[model samples]
Target chain A: MASDDTPAIRLAGLRKRYGTGDAAVDALKGVDMTVHAGEVVGLIGPSGSGKTTLLKCLGAVIEPTGGRMELAGEAIYDAERGGWQVGDLRALRRDRIGFVFQAPYLIPFLDVTDNVALLPMLAGVANGAARKRALALLTALDVAHRAGAQVSQLSGGEQQRVAIARALANRAPVILADEPTAPLDSERALTVVRILNEMAVQYRTAIIVVTHDEKIIPTFRRIYHIRDGVTHEEAGEGRPV
Target chain B: MAGVYRGMVDDGQVLIDNSGADLWVVQQGTLGPYAEPSSIRDDVWRGIAGIHGVAETGNAAYLTMQIKQGGHEARVMVVGIEVDRPGRPGAPPYLTFGRPILQGHYEAIADEKTGLKLGERVRIRRHEYVVVGLTRRMVSSSGDPMIFVPLKDAQEIQFLKDNDALINERARTAANPAFNRPGVPGLLEAAQASATQARNVNAVLVRLAPDVDPDTVAGEIRRWKRLTAYTRAQMEDILVAKLIATSAKQIGMFLVILSVVTAAIVAFIIYTMTLAKVREIAVLKLIGAKNRTIAAMILQQALGLGLIGFLVGRVAAGLWGPAFPKYVLLVPGDALRGFAIVMAICALASLVAIRAALRIDPAEAIGG
Candidate 1:
């Protein structure tokens, strides 16, 4: 069980290698990071800097060659085991982590409410209860009016908001956003960042936003810059949105 | 004669020809080849007449022969009946033109399909007969037109050898030296006279008393007369089951091939539909949807398509069944069985698409 003082996510000496022998290429080398509850952090790097690889390792989509990772208060990966400690990585991902991608890839056949409620349903929640939870999150995200609309009928901004609502539907402790605001205008980009901040504080969730977008970089109070498979932490200007 | 024996009238009962007889008796194991002539000694008619339930009995001869008409040979079934009355047991059920064959020889009644007009002459077995009447739908089991001739003429056509063959047979017998001895003068003539006589009939047709059951009469004849008698139901079985067994097997093979083709087409369609949604599948997996959930969706879609196709096919078959040249029976039980097979095929066909959907990697949804 997680305690109040436990960090939402922690990583130390996380390392990943692509292959073995002479052809092997190390993607991550001795990276360390931590994000507490109720905080949102930024990860920015150039191409081939291992940002995506590290995010994948943190999300448990890929295994780290050597590392220690803690989610909430539970130990998920250990360097000695050389793998994840969770019995089922898929269930671990569904119950403990959320993801928002560059494009809002909502299921085309499902309506907005069902698109958001699907996560809870997969986690063994009843259909009606899942929909209620989805409606509540949609109301908080200000997209409740389009709850019954198809994903294709919504505007670009509306679709991204629905994706955010889906990410928060399961009340997961951590969310990894991969260039989520990349396709938005500056105003919409800042609006997405502000919503992320509000959601992080209200739900006590830890969020890591990975991006190369210069327009929204200043909104983060702390940013980690990666160069050559290594991360260096620095303080952002923390400009208000 | 075969067609008349098996035809269903408007009231759904088997049509009885002018033959007021209810049942037919033939030699054992000879019912299958009804058109081929078989001799029963001509005296069996007396034994059949003595049966307890028999009201009347008549002897008939059947032969399939080629008749010369307008420089062409037409295959026909020549039937022989005792024309003593207007509506005898072996006469055509109804006539459309001219009149029945009142004389016992040299007169004929032909089916309309034979193209024989009233008062026209046709040659059969070195004898010219005048067609006196025309009938409709009077055909043999193989759809050959029937030509009704008198009892004695039909017997000669069925049993008498050609002139040359008969002369050769008599010469061979005389050369044997067993019947040509000097003391046996009448023995040789007696043998020749017996050879020239035509005294056999193919079957005996019997009419039962009003209150007697045909099965009971058939049993009695079989027990006492040492011959085979067939009731109406038994005759129907012989015509439908035995005669058409090969055709039924051919149709069964065609149905199997059609089902296989339908399954392959369904599988291809479902596989293509799944491929179109590959991106959506990745997204679904990344959002933590289970494999079974995706599989069930594809299965349901396949079954829905099959249901629509089956309903349309059934309606089309029903609309066109009556117009077929032969009888096409579309029973409810066959339709239900077809429905079950369609659903099973759809379920099996969706497996290919389900397997493809399950193999989609969730990492593809989150590009690096």
Candidate 2:
């Protein structure tokens, strides 16, 4: 029995080192952060900082050398074990975590509906149920009209919306977005930010957006500035959508 | 029916010659003139006729010779048939033009493949004969053309020696004390005379009555005559299984090499297609697609390519098989077996692509 106030995602002293000995590079010395449910935080940094590394650690794409990570009140990694606690990391990523890349990266052979439905399918949901869930997400993201179209047939903004729909399909507890709006114009970028904020609150999902784009920087209510493989939290303007 | 022989009996109605003949006597396991010649005396036919279940019999001689025509020599199998009787066992089944040989000597009927026109002179041994008829597909088992000649003429041409060789042989015999003794002067002459005469034929072809059993007759011939006799089935086995065994082995080796080349080509093509989609594969892995799913996709694509190739190959073979010089037997069983083999090869070929795809790291999808 966990309390209602438990954070959606929490990291305490997350460390990742690339190699050993004097030639080794420490990508993330120790990253500590927390985001509650229904919160959207911005992870901003310079080029050589550990923004990408921290996002990868949270997304479970790469293993952190030493860390304690918690998702929805469960400890997924502990520094004492030196690895993830889950038996199958891939299943954890499929069922609990969502990712949005700089590029849409939708599978070219599938239509928009299939692209969004794939996440639920991978988690062993039936085909009809998965497609229904995908359709509901597309409706929420305002891309339902293009659900039957091929990924190549969609415009840039439409592709981004579809990608967002995919990220929200499985109702994951957390979403790690790596520069999701970098390729869009200023107006389109703000629209994407507003959509992300709405979806976060609507689904009660905690999202961390890693970006260097100046257009949507002020949209975040809380911002973590990482430099020299470390993070410092600061409050944003908290502008209204 | 195209290569098999059918000849007219005394009634002038054509029937398969093997069906008309109850038993055939030849050297054991020899079916064509390409092998060493075997002969039995003409008197043996008399012994064969007296056997039970034996009805009527004819004598035939086989010899492969080089026939000179238009200043070019061609190898042909000369068959000696009885010119004294019409519809003899050794006669050509049918003729397309001209007439059968009416004279006992100095006349011949040739297969169309011999390229002999009517009234053209062909020299065999020390004699010349005019071609009187042309037959189609009257070839020996090994596809050599057949030339029909009178029995006595064929025996002489096959056995007679040249004048110089004969003289030398006689002098050599005379110098040997065992054969040239003055006490047995007539003995040497008797031997010389016997050597000049042709008293033997290669085999006796026997024809039975309508109600007779050929297997029983063949058994009696072998028992009483003390010679090898063959029923049609036995002869077919000897010709197809024993005589052509080496040729079958050669064809089997060719098929093995072709299968290996097909496997290699399929592996290369599948590997190239898999390489083209490496980025997509990494993304799929990052998105939690299992390794088996990716492998199955590649395997199915490879099998599809093989199916397309097999269909095209089968159609091409069907269209061009008749144009080849030798017979090309393409049966449905062979095609089905070939399809199975192609599918198995394609499945095995996709393994290389699968191994490469499984090694892709999912983290590569994220930069750095």
Candidate 3:
């Protein structure tokens, strides 16, 4: 469960470095950001600006050099705790955080419903209940009619919608979207952003969208512009979809 | 190839089982009658029968040669058995059609594999014999079908020379000073007759009385009669362990090599299939799929492919087995063993792909 009183995602002094000594390179110098529950914020950056690194760090896919991260009201990573406070990062990611990639990246072997249901199944939910949850999300995303279809049979926009449903299937408090609408046209990209907003408000989740696509930039209530290894917050137009 | 070798081994066992003998008395100091040649005087059976523990004795001759039938030639093993009694040793255990040899000389009982029909005439050397009966599973150690003929005919066919060679031999004998001496009367003719006649058989099959130990009788024959006697167990060893040992070893090596090649092919296929799904695997990991889960997916795929392959191979072998020149015996035990081996190979082969999939970075799905 998420609430506006406690932010779903919070980071302070997050840092990441690659290699050592003479070949050492700092990917994320220091980052500070927060997004309350039921909000979708945009992250825009050029190449080599550390957006993907930050996303990886938040997704618990990579270890941070130094950071304090609290998700779903639990401090998962703190430098003073000598790294991660969570014992199992895989379970932590599975239960609390969801990710939507640049491409749909659905498991092609599974049909559309199963692709969404697999997350809950991996978390030990019963198969019937997991499929019921997946079907509910697919209905919310307006792709319920294709629940029995394979991933390859779906159109591009339909596949992306299914990916969104999959990310929201576990009822995770935090959803991280990395260029999720990059492959879509203007109308589809805006549609993807509108769906993200509706899903965030409906599920009470904090969403962060990192994209180079300018088509959906104005839809965010706020934006974070990252340069080199640092992030700067700015006020967005917050235009209506 | 291993199947054929197994069939050959089984063929040898069938012949031994059909003989229904407790002991095989071969020539002294020789491994014979099936894997090697042996020749003892035709009267050796009479001496063997007189032994205390011996219940009965029968003489048998075995020779392999091409027989012509209906303008076609097929190599077969000619087996000579005594036709004087119904239940003699070295007789075909059972007849599938017609009757056993009645008159003895020109009547032959042929294995159905020889393609000889009842009453068909086949030429064995200088004699054309009528096929009087047909038997099944009667084959030599080398997988050639067996044609049962009378002892006299088999011996003559095995030892008798052609007309020109016989005449040359008689003339040569008449010109010899040793046989044609002035004081000699019928000596040259006796010598010629002895030279031309075949008075030897391959071996003597001995049947022992009930509750009598074959080893004891065999030991007595070897000691007093000065003949090499093989008990049923020893004969089986001679057939399975010695007769076809080299061929079995060669076939075993071929099977090992084929298994390795099949493993390599399966490994390559699984690896290629894994590489094709790199993105999907990465996404699975990115979404918190456990290593065991992904590994199981790959393993299941490999095992499925192996199952399909095994079924297809079994069907193909069943379809083509009968067309081979030799017997291709497919045992249920062998099929079960083959299925287990295929699944084991497939499981082991998928390790490479499983390792590759495990090493894939979940970040690859998100991209830089």
lDDT of 3 by residue, B115-153 (tens): 999999898888899999999999998889999999999
Worst 10 residues of 3 chain B by lDDT: B1-10
Q: How accurate is candidate 2 locally (lDDT)?
A: 0.80
Could you say which candidate leads in DockQ? 3
Instruction: Sort by lDDT, best first.
Output: 3, 1, 2
lDDT of 1 by residue, B131-163 (tens): 999987676655567899998898899889999
Residue pairs with backbone atoms closer than 3 Å in model 3 (clashes) = none
Give the better candidate number (1 or 3) by TM-score: 3
TM-score to native of every candidate shown: 0.68, 0.71, 0.92
Worst 10 residues of 3 chain A by lDDT: A1-10
Per-residue alpha-carbon lDDT of candidate 2 for residues B168-257, written as tens digits (9 for 90 to 100)? 888877777777778876988877776677877887888777788889888887676767787766655555556555656666677788
Clashing pairs in 2: none
Sorted on DockQ, best first, the list reads 3, 1, 2
DockQ values per model: 0.40, 0.40, 0.67
Please report, in order, the local distance difference test score of every candidate based on alpha carbons. Answer: 0.82, 0.80, 0.91
Candidate 1 residue B358 C-alpha distance from true site, Å? 3.3
Give model 3 RMSD, 1 decimal. Answer: 2.7
